[model samples]
Target: MPKVLNITAARSRLTSLVQEAFLEQKRTLIGKHGVPMAALLPIREYEELLQDLEDLGDMLQAEQEYRRTGGKDFEDVVKKPKGRR
Candidate 1:
């Protein structure tokens, strides 16, 4: 696991901590009472992580809906669709 910093120390060096995360491509775990509360990560990584989560949710919903509708996969349902390339 990456090294962790307490809330007080993190507050004092927020700028450097952010710089370290960016420059070293490492995460800074911040927390209180020895329990991690949050993480400092590169902006791109954070955005990608969020997008991955959204994609996972989308896949799960699609699976549930397809089961309810008794539908096959899109490829099996259609030979070709309009305005899709």
Candidate 2:
């Protein structure tokens, strides 16, 4: 679990928290009214998360296209006969 820091305390240690999260792979959960509102994470970790989301979206689009096409492969749709120029 990530360490939780309320808004005021987190504000005071923002620089150090960034260092901790970025250099040490630690995570800090920032909250207001004792409710988690945001997270601080390393840049690389955030990029990986974005990439995972993109890949999942691509898979969903492929699945939907497959259902619409009744499992026809994309190559089959674009392939030409041997005699074609």
Candidate 3:
């Protein structure tokens, strides 16, 4: 489980919180009025999450393009007989 801290308390312990994220690879959830508002996590983890989102977006775009093109493979279309369009 991640460590949870209200904004006030987190402000007082910001240095240690940053160290925990960098060295320990731990997440800290910052909350306000009992609602989680943000997080502190390792930079590498954040980058990986961004990459995953990009990959998902690319896959969805490819699916949409395939559907728009009537699902014909590009290679199959190219290999058709010369007179057939």
Candidate 4:
């Protein structure tokens, strides 16, 4: 489970909290009034998360472009006549 850190506590012990997240590879959730506000995670994890988001965005854009371009039928591209030059 992720560790919860209130805003004040996180501010007071920012260094330790960051170190703990890095060393343990655990998520640190910063909350305010019992509501989640932000998260602190290892840099590697953060980069992975960002990459996943970018991939998803690219996929969505491609799908939109395909739709706009009158998407091609898969069979038309894959079932070409073998003897055609």
Q: Which candidate tops TM-score?
A: 2
Estimate the TM-score for candidate 1: 0.79
TM-score of every model?
0.79, 0.80, 0.79, 0.79
**What tens-digit string does per-residue lDDT give for candidate 1 at 37-68?**
99999888999999999999999999999899
lDDT of each structure? 0.89, 0.91, 0.91, 0.87
Better of 2 and 4 by lDDT: 2
Instruction: Give per-residue lDDT, candidate 4, residue 61.
Output: 99
List the lowest-lDDT window of 10 residues for candidate 2: 1-10
Candidate 4 C-alpha lDDT tens digits along 1-85? 5656789999998998888879988678999876788998899999999999999999999899989998887798788699876
Which parts of model 3 have CA positions greater than 4 angstroms off?
1-3, 73-85
Which residue pairs in candidate 1 collide? none
The lDDT, on a scale of 0 to 1, for candidate 3 is 0.91
Question: Model 1, residue 54: what's the lDDT?
Answer: 100
* Candidate 1 Cα outliers beyond 4 Å, as residue runs: 74-85
State the local distance difference test value for candidate 1. Answer: 0.89
The local lDDT score (0 to 100) that residue 47 gets in candidate 4 is 98
Task: Write model 2 residue lDDT over 1-85, tens digit each, in one string.
Answer: 7656899999999999999978898888999877899999988899999999999999999999889888978799899989997
